[model samples]
Target: MNEIVTTRLKPVSANLSRHKGVRRHAAIFIAPALAVYLLIVIAPSIGTLWISFTKWKGIGDEAKFVGIDNYKQLWNNDTFRGSFGRTLTLLIAGGFVVFLFAFIFTMLIREMRSKKLIRAIVFFPNVVPPVALAIAWGVLLAPRNGLLNEFLELVGLTSQTRTWLGPDLLFRSIIAGLVWIYTGFFVTILMAGVDRIPAYYYEAAELEGASARQKFTRVTLPLTWDVLSVAAVLWVILAIKTFEFIYAFGGSGTDPSASSWTLPVHVYVVALGNRSPILALGQGSAIAVVMVALVGALIFLTRRVMRRAVVEF
Candidate 1:
C-alpha cells in the first residue's frame, strides 16, 4: 500500500511542476508587451488627467494648479459646446448610416459571383490616406468648377448646383464623405461575421417557406449580433477621434471653421493655438478627459444594450 501511494504522488508532483513552468514562460513572454503598454498608454493617460487640473502654456512656463477652473470654463464656452454637439451627432447619426449601408452591401455581396473583386473595390477607399481623400472631396465639391456641379450642368440640372463646400453645406458634405469612407470598413467586418454562419441554417429556414427578408431577420441578424456590437463600439471611438479628414476638407492652411469643428479638432485648436490668440493646454486636457469619460460611458451602455444570449450553431 505504501509503494502504490508513492507511485501516484510522483505523477501528481511532476504535473504540478510542469504547470508552474508553463506559467513562468508565459509571464516572460508577456512582460515586454505589458511594459510597453504601461509606458505609452497608461502613463500618458495619467499625465493628461493630472494636466486637466492645472494651467499651463505647454512650453517654457511652469504649470500652475487651478482646481476645476478649466472644466468650468469649457462648460461655459460656446465653441466647446458646439464641438461636443457635433461629436455626438457624428457618433450617433454617422454610425446609423454607416451600419445601414454596410448591411445592405453585405447582403448584396453575399450572393454575388464576383464578391471578392467587389469587396476589394469597396475597401479601396479605406486604405487611401484620409488627407488625400479629403482633398479629393474638396476638389469635387468646389463651387465654380467642381466635378459634381459640372455633372449637374451636363445633365441639364444646373439649378441643382450649389456651393457644396461653402458654410451652408460644408458640415453636411463632411458627414457624407465620412460615411462613404467608413461604410466599406464596416461591411468587411459584418461580412466576416456573416460568412461564419452555417449554410444549413439558411437552408432550414428556406424549407419552411421563409422569404429573403425573413431569413435575414431571423437567421443572419441574431448570429452576427456580437460582431455588430463590437463594430459599433469601434465606430464610436473612430468617430470621436476623427480630425484629419475634416481638417483637410475645410481648411486651406488655417484652422477649419467653428461650425465644422469636432472635439478632437477643438482640443488641437485650444492646445496648440492654431490661428487662435491664446493657448489653453489645461482646457484642452479637460476636453480630453471629457472625451475619455464619454467613450467609457457609451461603451458600457452599448454593451448593456447589445448583450444577448449566445446563439449556438
Candidate 2:
C-alpha cells in the first residue's frame, strides 16, 4: 500500500513542475517590448555610428566607407566649432541666470499677499507658442521701430540702438528670449520644493536672531540644493539641444558662415538642407553621440559635486 501511495504522488509532482514551466513561458512574453526598443532606438543609433565612419552623402545608391574622415572634417570645420562655442556660452548664461531668477521668484512668491495672479503672470510666457514668442521678440527688438530701440531713442540714447537680430546680436537675443520663457518653469519647480520645507525652521532661525538673508543662505539654499542641481542639468541639456528658437528667429540652413548655428542647427544644415551637398548623416550621428556623452558626464559630475544626504524633517 505504501509503494502504491508513493507511485500516485509522482504524477502530482510532474504537474507542479509543468505549472512552473508555464510561468517561465509567460515571462518570456516581455521580449516583444525589448525587441521593439532595440529596433527603433538601438538599431538606428548603431546605423548612424556606422554611417559616420563612411562618406555617404545622405542619398545615393552607393556609399563609400571612409573611416575617420568625417570626424577629421569636424575638427577643422570652423562653422561647427563656432556653434559649439556658442552652445557653451548659452549653457552658462541660461543655466545660472534662470536659476537666479527662479530662486528670487520663489522667495518673493512665498511672502506675497496675492500669489495666484503673480504666478499666472510669470508663467504665462511658458504657455505661449515658441513661434509667437520669437515673433513678439522680433518686433520688440527691431532696430528701427522696436520697442527697446524706440525707448532708447526717447531717453536720448539713440547711439546705443543697434539691430538686435543682427548676426552679432542674434545669440544674445536668443539667450534672453529662452531665459524669459524657461525661468518660470524652474521657478514653479523650486517653489514646490520650497513649500515642502517646514516654516518652523525659518521661525526658529528668526528667533535665533538670523537675518532674512542668513536664513535663506543657511537653511533655504541647503534644503533646495538637490532640486537646483537637477534644474542646472536640465538647463544644460536644453541649451545644448537649442534649435527651434534659433531657427525660428534666424532663417534656417547654414548661413554665410554659420553665424547663429548651434550643433542641432549644424546637423540640420548638413544633413537636411539642399545648399550643402555634403550628406551629414555620419557627422550628425557623431555629434549626437558626443552630445550624449557630454550630457552624461555633466550629470555624473554634478551629482558628485552636489552630493548631500537627504534631510528628513
> What's the CA error at residue 137 for candidate 2, in Å?
1.3
Candidate 1 C-alpha lDDT tens digits along 209-301: 999999999999999999999998999889999888988787865888888899988888788845763578889899999999999999999
Candidate 1 residue runs with Cα over 4 Å from true position = 1-17, 273-277
Q: What are the Cα lDDT values of the candidates?
A: 0.90, 0.79
lDDT of 2 by residue, 137-204 (tens): 87888777899999999999989998898889988888898888888888888887888889998999
Clashing residue pairs, candidate 1? Answer: none
How many clashing residue pairs, candidate 2? 1
